[model samples]
Target: MMKTMKILTALAATMATIPAVAHEIWVERDASGPARIYLGEPAEAVPEAGDPEFHHLQKPQAIQSDDKPIAFVRRANHIEATVPGSGDVRVRDDSVFAPWKSGEKMQGAIFYARAGRSETAAKLDLELVPAAANADRFTLLFRGKPVPAAKLTVITPDRWQKAFFTDANGGVEIPKLGAGRYIVGASHTEEGPAKLGGQDVASVVHISTLTFVR
Candidate 1:
């Protein structure tokens, strides 16, 4: 009993270090017809658009029938993107809080246009893409390479969430998905160059998300 209690205490402490936001990005249509970009957790509640921590790492990219460039319109709560043709739009928030005394945090977002499925818009730190051969399978990439054994959390249209791990090639297969809209998320952390609090350190967190409608 004492050993079990000690294990439980340790687990609790470890979980405390995790952030409450667990940010994610997705695109949804607004009343004006243009797609609006959101940054937050879709599984729990509407993204905290007003969260001060939400900021673009770089200019957002959009690929549609014309391959036009789209920019993020920063609003009081959330950001918006104008997709002219509707192919794929992506945004990266690189090292949003890098050089922190604790570590660095980054985010990537991908939106698949209803017209076709394709690769990520921007190959940032991490990426989640659909498998070429199977619609139910997916591939997770870290630093533009396959990431083996990475954890993937999937949220279905009905708000059902499940966790999965990648195979040797960073591939994951979801046997059951009736499909509507789905959000796939993956995160990885490693030791990397960082300047935090005026001191050099080695720690970074990379988070990526893929949002699609079937």
Candidate 2:
């Protein structure tokens, strides 16, 4: 209980230091193969104004559904990979963006992304886990505890978007979710004195997304 309070306090101190809404990273995948990870807004798909250069994606991991580690292939506009298993395939890049100046302090960010809504355990520091297999309702967690009243943004496959807030228990439900890929994003910032690329930083940010097709 004390640890959760400390984390929540640290988050409150740093959330305003950096704006979490910006070009985000997300993943789209099929059940057995072909996962394309993007470094920009999904509304444009790719090669659009909001999309950054695909090369900006750093060493992101393809957390598989099974015990075996799947391989990734880098392409010109996106990272391509053949993923195994029928469950959710998660991806993350701790160094997607290099440490940069946020006014006078150096700030760093870590992006966490998922490509399915199947029943999957939390693997990243921040994740949007489905309530059940292929469920639309989700729970937001920080260090494995509910994060009350956090903002969660949902982008439907048709490019419609709406932001929802988590309840006291960090739970939210996606309304009228339909076919195609959906991207759900949330972020958290921690007051930090941490190292990135051998450089120290004042705060570290975490942005997470859950993308799944109905």
Candidate 3:
């Protein structure tokens, strides 16, 4: 029992380093229709933006509106891109690498986005999206492939949180939800070390997020 407790304690500590809402990027449309990229929890009263500490990767790249290139402007807290007419707009941030601890390395801060009813893959280290329009099922991908048994945390419009895991096909079924906004997040840590933050550390933790309105 003591050994089990120790393992659980260590797991908790590791998770503490990655906040429940950190490392997630999603698109939000203002009243006028222009899309803004936000970096934190979309469910927050005022979801935070940007990751100056860990966003050592290059600026957002491959920003597009239905395959047509769109320019992105960096703001104090978030990145903004104009949506052209919206069929399936997608954007991704540069991947950043950093030392998780002594001898462990991790790369992350990757983000992907698309608007409404479209189930496209961002093809990042990890990706999340709804299965279909008004669907309660979601799919997760790792390195552009299905991530079976991946764990996820889902936040509803009212801030209710639930824990779930992907099935054999990297899919998760969520409870029937009301219309507002939602955020689903997942993460994975690998044993191999990658060069990040100018040094070599231990393992790499990859985080992904998907946000949409019903």
Q: Evaluated with TM-score, which candidate comes out highest?
A: 2
Better of 1 and 3 by TM-score: 3
Two-way lDDT contest, 1 vs 2, winner: 2
Off by over 4 Å in 3: 1-21, 30-32, 47-58, 63-67, 75-77, 95-98, 102-109, 113-115, 120-122, 197-202
Per-residue lDDT value at 175 in model 3? 70
Candidate 1 versus the native: TM-score?
0.67
* Each prediction's TM-score versus the true structure: 0.67, 0.83, 0.68
Q: What digit string (tens of lDDT, one per residue) describes model 3 on residues 104-127?
A: 434333356544436554545666
Worst 10 residues of 1 by lDDT: 107-116
Task: Pick the lDDT winner.
Answer: 2
Residues 1-214 of candidate 1 have per-residue lDDT tens digits of: 9999999998787555444446655566523356665655668656344543456323344434455566667765556676665455555544334333232442222222221236433345576666662267777777668899998887887889999999999889865676676777787776666553344556656666776666
lDDT (CA) for every model shown? 0.59, 0.80, 0.62
Q: Which candidate would rank higher by TM-score, 2 or 3?
A: 2
